[model samples]
Target: MDNLATTWVGATAKQISRAVRRGDTTATQVVADHLEQIAISDPALTAFRVVRGGEAIVEAEKVDDQEDLANLPLAGVPVAVKENTAVAGLPTWHGSAAARTAVAEEDHEVVRRLRGAGAVVVGVTRMPEMGLWATTDGADGPTRNPWSLDRTPGGSSGGSAAAVAAGLVPIAQGNDGLGSIRIPAACCGLVGLKPGRDVIPCDLGVDNWLGLAENGILATTVADAALGFSVLAGRSPAKLTPPDRLRVGVALRSPVQGVRADEPNRDAVATAAKLLGQAGHDTVTAEPPYTTGVRIAGLLTWFAAAYREAQASGLDLKTLQPRTRRHVRLGKMAWNRGWVRQEQRDAWRAKSLAFFEEKNIDVLLTPALATTPPPADGHSGGSWRHNLIENIRYAPYAGPWNIAGLPAIVVPIGLRPDGLPVGVQFVGKPDSELLLLSIAGVLEVANPWTRHAFV
Candidate 1:
């Protein structure tokens, strides 16, 4: 690999793709350099579960052999897929030993689209078992934040977030059932977007219940997130320009009643709202539409889905993590209630839409998390009840958007006195992704975030 090509580690997905298309660097070189970076950096970070160097080299060779690379928007960009998502020839290791070790027969729909865009999949990142928690720790180990190793990267997309934040890959794909993508991004200080329901196919290759989760991208910049999102969503990746003056509503409240956001996180929301006001957008305080009961129902549905996955995987119950097994027990009990069904999920989505329409707000601004990432070892190996309370307290702001099925993006505002990044989220109604992207694009330029951590 060319020594200078190692710099590709800092390049955005768009920059890398353009360079590869223009022949400034070969796809193989880009992939090799990224793999090398992973070799050097990932052991300390514990971000990726597997690195597909051979498979990625073969794919990069195919891209190099192509005569017209212009059609491929992501011509040579390296991406990390969350381990929970199906990637052909790789185990969909849902961060649990109980998850089957069989390699996926085919790529998930979003992964397939990414390949069609000429992007190279370097590896699979880690997550919590069955992706049921906020911090990224499982049978493997905990994924530490690049900013502060003692801090968590956030989960269930913690590995993806850590990889992107540490500059291991320009972009990493993640999924959000109840704030998995956004929470990790917030912790890592990257742009993480969860597109509204049906805006991106969520159940392409996996059997998902609740339909609460959707695939998304974690990137250093808004443009990179938009680029990867376009490729994964099968749309033409275009520039995200400034949006019109939006009516932005700010909510500092937590989704759960007893969970109050810490001072720093509340200040993050206030700071973000002030920035929007300075940018000429109308800003006002607003609370999330759904009630605590609705959120509870959604939480139960998510737990029930986790239980079903554990049961279907056929792994011996003894092999499962204790916390996971407890979740399974609770989920089974919740499933008995008959409320974690499609109709109820749709009703929650409808309520969210109605709230947005009635408020006449173009976007909603809220804290990305209740606190910065908790201690790396804070919740690891704890009892299920302890994990439950800690996870809820750590991420009080993120789950409601998933419950609402709205497009929500987390952007880094700045950092806490302790040096960890603080992110605030901007949420839009269903199918309002473009608007949210445009707004994020504008904010990104105004308050540019440092792309690289101290290496």
Candidate 2:
């Protein structure tokens, strides 16, 4: 047996699970190591809203007590849930104290699935108020990027990304309404996968950002991500295989007008395309139909989601953060105007799918982010307009995919010239979750990236 005191802080989820199943180490010991690391590292990053210290140890003990462990895919792994998600006994802090909901009596479906798969929930991570912005910060403080404390990890999954990048947890649960998961994955150099709509249960805020939001996994390796995704989707874990030769559509154009990918971001896409070629895939220049209606309706739907969430949570608008208050107000206006229509969203989804058929491509590749992450702190209490602008300017790629209700995954290609990490996005057709993971796995092996930030 290995030393019980040996830290498993930096080990991948698969490694930890395999070790525990083999009886090389106890689940308690692994959870203890991760909890200790969280104690040491999370103070600097503010990644967790609350650390489930004693509770997690007890859960890990339960895993160790199981008579048979062959079926537990995530056996003994420590995972973090995004603050907005329920984790029975914890109040769902929807980004801030004012937005918190009552203590949950039972686990959310995804949380239950994780626990059933032999994972322990260490804590829930933080996010922006009502998850309205791309930079994660609240009255508690900013969730600093592990790569660079001055920059954000990216939101609303910022805390989850920071926790995984700092090795505080092997993987985490994050929901991407806009670019929440992928943007942070790009910023922190991790694999973030947002499944197509309805692939996994959403049940978040009223209507899940008008069907634009979906739950996802963030991890340092593609293997861990695939494991987490399979658990969430309630499927048996399957090994990822290299895909056959596929024609991949490559685009450098930003989805949002007047916002273009910077040199490093564009180069990241190029790097990803080159890796695809080396993997025996064809890459062609193809742009999705980012029509004027899709852009405007998507923006209005984003605004209206905030308004609907506030109303459903019974949160007093006056008590919300200044930026969130404005967002909710705008949401109300957008809702009243009937601008966020289901027909428009369906139309875009149809158009997005047809682009692949017309272009004869298996998947589309684009820059995960347009520019570097914004400053982490000031935006929390600052102007709503500034928050919106900064978010759209840096992260214009991931939102359109969400609007299209298609699966998208972000794979870290390499580091940027500024020392922060950069990643590229791969959008696939419906029911192509495994295909997207396969493509990411290929890039991961062809050109490896730093697994975790040197926090």
Candidate 3:
């Protein structure tokens, strides 16, 4: 039996809102379509850690009951929140076995912002344990890409990408500490934007000491992402038009030494550069400004964050995953080293700031990943130490932006011969999201891919 509700699965967030607000469709129907698609698709995709169909229906009814649609730009739009974030009644286990499984008592500030914008929280998506892995396999299971069930969806925002790609939802909230959102978006053929540092509110309330992570959106269209950003950011994105003859730096090599991008990945970058040239940008080959100390400082800060999370879990170290336990110990060591190395870290930040401020480049383009999504079960079977090394080999291009606290976005450029998606990344100076997004929007129109999953 074909559910007529499934028809709305392919609709964008804007389309759904327009229909619902104009009385062409009801909020209840839109939510029903998404919940039905989730029921049909998530079993194969493993995209959602939790589905809140009952609560989402109730919420939709509330949207229907509201008399004013003027303030609700996203009224009744079904959206997914990453499990690591709080949503009042959902468990924020953060994909860890040792963490509390109880539902949250209050919404994270990001969730509050989304709800206030009239977006419906349909479910919480899955992630790796504490977002330690690029693949979205957790205690729950691995999330498979809709295009290839044998392949991973990419994480820690893998589930969100999978959900959006599968047409199960129009928009999903994802946080990127290290390519969690953009990597998955690249692998799953969607638009993923990691906003400038602190653009989106943190779960813990203005307390992102490292400032490496930011909540963002994974959507099928640039307009949808822009809409989500506006709602989450509590303001409009810059309306500035991209300057004619923009200076675009094309980066083909990974910043990490000894790791090279695959041919398809390299080709993606070349293709992007050509497209930008056609769009009137002065494209030039460029290399990332690398400081010897940046990588070390980033690793230490990551470990420190891990250590704090492990300690906060209150569970015995033995009960946690081996990776988490190791990170906790290493993080403690890094925290101790922070006293001496803080200056090096600051210097690295200055170097990054100078790279953008001093350089005349408007955007730096690079391959989103070293390669297309690796085998779903690959790079994960070995010891935690081995797995971490494998992760770096696969995703060498992701961490630099997070460490630099800059804005970066990944959009699908083309698919590989095997039909897997390949993406190119665009990095911008601090708070240059509007310009970056404008550039991306132009490219998106130039080479439009299917908005729905290829499958």
Candidate 4:
């Protein structure tokens, strides 16, 4: 229908679903439009490990064939699943060939929920091997940021973020263990939400990184993010309401001892504070209690997660990338010493929750990242020390929240001096996912950033 919108490539999930449900366009056309966009653009970003072109079209046709679309929340919208997750009939490519698993007989629970909500899985996006590093790259190639090709789309959810930033998909599914989803969202100028622990079922590899990881959504808009979150969490889609006046705690301190937010990231926090103030929310300078013990426990758990996944998958550690192999070895040592304990994480969770009550705040605000994203090149082949240093220096702000198992979101504030996107993180008490989304929506309306990268 040339009379209709020329293309649905950049449409939000809500817009696309409404159009398809209203008979303005067919699901097949929408899926075809997105597939064409992916074919034209994904080669540059290397965002996907697989594109289900034929299968996606067939699924879209099935959606159109259904007699009633009244109950579908994401009717006809295209989505990308992170490569680490299972999609039926496709081998799970855990970032590289060496880490690839056999074809999944059935979809993961999250994928099943998305399909049930009428979303089509167009492809599975790439990640770092075993999702060990913050930067996304592998033997195939690096997943570059859509904002700047030279800079990284921070990972291990990098590919998912890139696809959404470039409008290949309106929303992509990602899981955050140690800031995987939020880091990429920050780098690519999107809204990324990591729900509090166990809010959504996370049957990810070998115990979901010892319960630090949770399945989440990354999207160009807060409404789409909330829609995706609802689908994954198996709840009815709810409209996001503007939140009541909140007492927000603003902190510029980096969780890592040696790393601090660069000037651009700090400015991003300041910008967010001003927006909150303009929205009738109070802001105060308050820092979460990120103690030395919490930092050490989080690092050990991160290393142990690598070891657990590799061992449980029966992967030959020597065949993995050099940096990953070193990480696995350290994980084994940590496991042997019993350093990665549940009690340590639980302690941090208790302390983090107390900070809100002790300070009399409803939400906590912090820079999404410590500095700009690292370079996209050569990280997959770099030495273990270099990769570790680069990752920690730029992304030290996200892991502590994961350790605490609190709901956190990253919302883009503005662009950096060097033209990369910058964002700020908001952490709320348990069961505050919707509250976090409401705040993000306020930011989106108050300071509307570019919806898509000008790729």
Candidate 5:
């Protein structure tokens, strides 16, 4: 895989599996090819924190020997998991040294499903500490954007996005508690989908707020993301979510996030909204109840989670990257839970559902990232400062959906002048991840964005 790697990076799991099933390509060959590519390309890319080379080969061989149709859908696909996920033999560190010693005892439910479906787990990608930041600026360091070596790939899920974008893997699993998945997708020119919480079972009993993030796939095509959903979606991982009549709601953000419909992001989402309307779905440009208050209210949950982590472990808060340190400070300050604020946020959630129910709005559409792609050199804030603001201003929409525990899919719709990507999000009702993925496939067919390579 070279510049030619673009074709394979964008290959859907379905394509890889079909090749393996037909004996056109052995799973061993496919996994080896990606491993070789990773060897040559991943050093500067800095996309992985854990490389499971030998371990992955053993698993890929299982695919080669597998004759049963039980794992038919993803037999030869090479995938990367965010370092935060436990993959049996591999360690699941939340990108922190404190976790370095805690090797995983077993596969996380998400990892288990991917393995059960026969996707090869090549390695674990990088992320910010505890997924606290939107940019992948970890205490460990930043992961570069594949589209431009000097730019960021976007964070928490940054390395996963970079790996998939750089053609290291066909798909990489990403979790978005904040805008982790979409941020990188926008930065790297890929498709990212964050489904409703627990639409897939999380074996560990994580706190509800921090659990806002859900594991999803970052791929070059919507179908690739759809394929992951088929192989590794829901509690047991189901086949492709069927497409159906989906009513779409449009939430143009309030003026506070610093941009609007006049902006490219706004236009991209509006265009998507119009396309949905033209597709015979109902589309309305409106606001959910706590529309104006989401930014402030949502921060409560994000900060609370960060605060708890820091206090519980005394997280060496000072040692964290500056912006993250500041977040820990802010989180510590919010010891008081504002039920009124939560009530408003919850009311917005209820209102959103009532509207969805009334208008039969099965899905909602909005900007994946509030602003355009950040400069390739990354945000202008001090590493910590930039990390903080980038998370807030650029990623205003994704978290609200996360807080609501609703499913959302981000599909790349267009590219920026710098050759970066921009995406629109589709928010669905709770547990509607399958429905969201199916709709993403429809929109993906309506507009495909891929084959981008940095080298």
Candidate 6:
């Protein structure tokens, strides 16, 4: 029953909610169709590490009967959860052999919210061992791009990004700590957003290092991303909607170290800016003091926490994927600080606040990554580093927002010359996600991206 394929396939969150209200579709059909798609594609793409056929059907059956579920915001929508997030009765493998047999006894907050909203969780997507390197399936040796089975899907949330981009589901969950969500979104050609720290309670992630990570989503459309953000945020009922006026910031310098902007990425950002301008908002292109040194410092801080966690968990650092282990090990080292690291962090915060104060800009815009898509397959030792350093340049655009505990959004402006998609991120101040979402809704109407990259 291709409830998702032919039915409101491109339908926004509002449309899906309405369809469920009208009983034109039931949560069971939506979950079933997506489950069917996963059954077919998982073997070829290896996008998902685990598929929950029985659990999804059971939840959907409940939605099918309950009138309350039909009226719920996400009544019949089907979604994928990243494996790292716990789902009661499912294995919460942080993508490692250690947790291979460790099924979660309770649902993670993210999963709880999704179920509470009546969304059917059809499956849990793949991740690198504990989300170490952007190693989506490099750990399991299965993760690859749906577009080109040979390319990498961008780590951590790569499975989620790939699942949605492939249209297996309209949207899927992703966790971003150091560009995990955005990186996969960029590579898979989907919309991804990282909310401000504390915007969503991360019960398992106890890191004090602000920038190393946060949770977000990958969706076929910006609205799907918005709905996912809305539900997961657990915003107090007092905040019903995002504000109307949002302050937006534009970055003049690249956040990656020693790297200049790539043509496709720049073109994409320019396209998004033009859309922002047409939408009748003030825009500026000044260097926002966002820097790579700050990135290194933040990574170190994150590694300190991750290392402590690894030691406590008694997980073998060596058993982890090489890239993830290498980076996490590097995180245990000394800080690469001076005037630059501290200054970037401080100045960016001030710049963010002033951007809103002076220009009434509440959100910032930039590329998730500075390059076009890469091969879906994992890269080798040194070549991987060079590729990551060059191709994944400017990931900081999304990172700074996470550090500031601000929310960020990305939707495709359009695709590049090579037929791969290029995207720009919209970042909102802390708790201003509702406003950022409304802004995204405006752009969505202006330029809608149909998940047309693959057949």
lDDT of 2 by residue, 275-336 (tens): 89988999999999898898898789998999999988788988988888998899899999
Using alpha carbons, what is the TM-score of model 1?
Answer: 0.96
Q: Write the per-residue lDDT of candidate 6 for residues 1-455, one digit (tens) a residue.
A: 22234544444455666677688777676677667667766776777777888888998898878856443677777888888888888877777676454777988888888888878888888876667556455534657776667767777688888778777777788887766787788777777877776777676554534344677778876666777777788642223333344446676456656666578888777777777787776677645555555566555555565665565567677675565566556555533322214454555666666666675556677776666555655443334365345334534455666555567777777777866667777776677666666776666777886573432
Model 1 agreement with the true structure over 1-455: per-residue lDDT tens digits: 22223777778888999999999999999999888888878888899998998989999999999999999999998899999888998778888756756888999888998889989999999888778889988656788998999999999999999999988889989999889999998999999999987877787223554677888889999889898888878898877777788898888877787877788888888877777788888987778765866777777887888777766666576777788878877888888877567666677778877877778888899888887688887464789889888888889777777766788999988888899998889999778887887888777877888876633
lDDT of 4 by residue, 274-339 (tens): 999999999998998889999899889999999989889899988999999999999999998888
RMSD of each: 2.2, 2.1, 2.2, 2.0, 3.1, 3.8
Cα lDDT of candidate 2 equals 0.92
Cα-based lDDT at residue 40, candidate 3: 82
Q: Put the candidates in lDDT order, highest first.
A: 4, 2, 1, 3, 5, 6
lDDT: which is higher, 2 or 6?
2
Span of 10 residues, lowest total lDDT, candidate 6: 236-245
Report the number of the highest-lDDT candidate: 4
Per-residue CA lDDT of candidate 5, range 315-427, in tens? Answer: 67655656666776777677554422457556656766786777666777877777655544443226656665656666666677776767777877877665667778887
What TM-score does structure 5 among the candidates reach?
0.89
- Show the lowest summed lDDT stretch of 10 residues, model 5: 372-381
After superposition, candidate 6 runs with Cα above 4 Å error: 1-17, 99-101, 208-212, 235-247, 291-293, 335-360, 380-396, 452-455
Residue 246, model 5: lDDT of 60
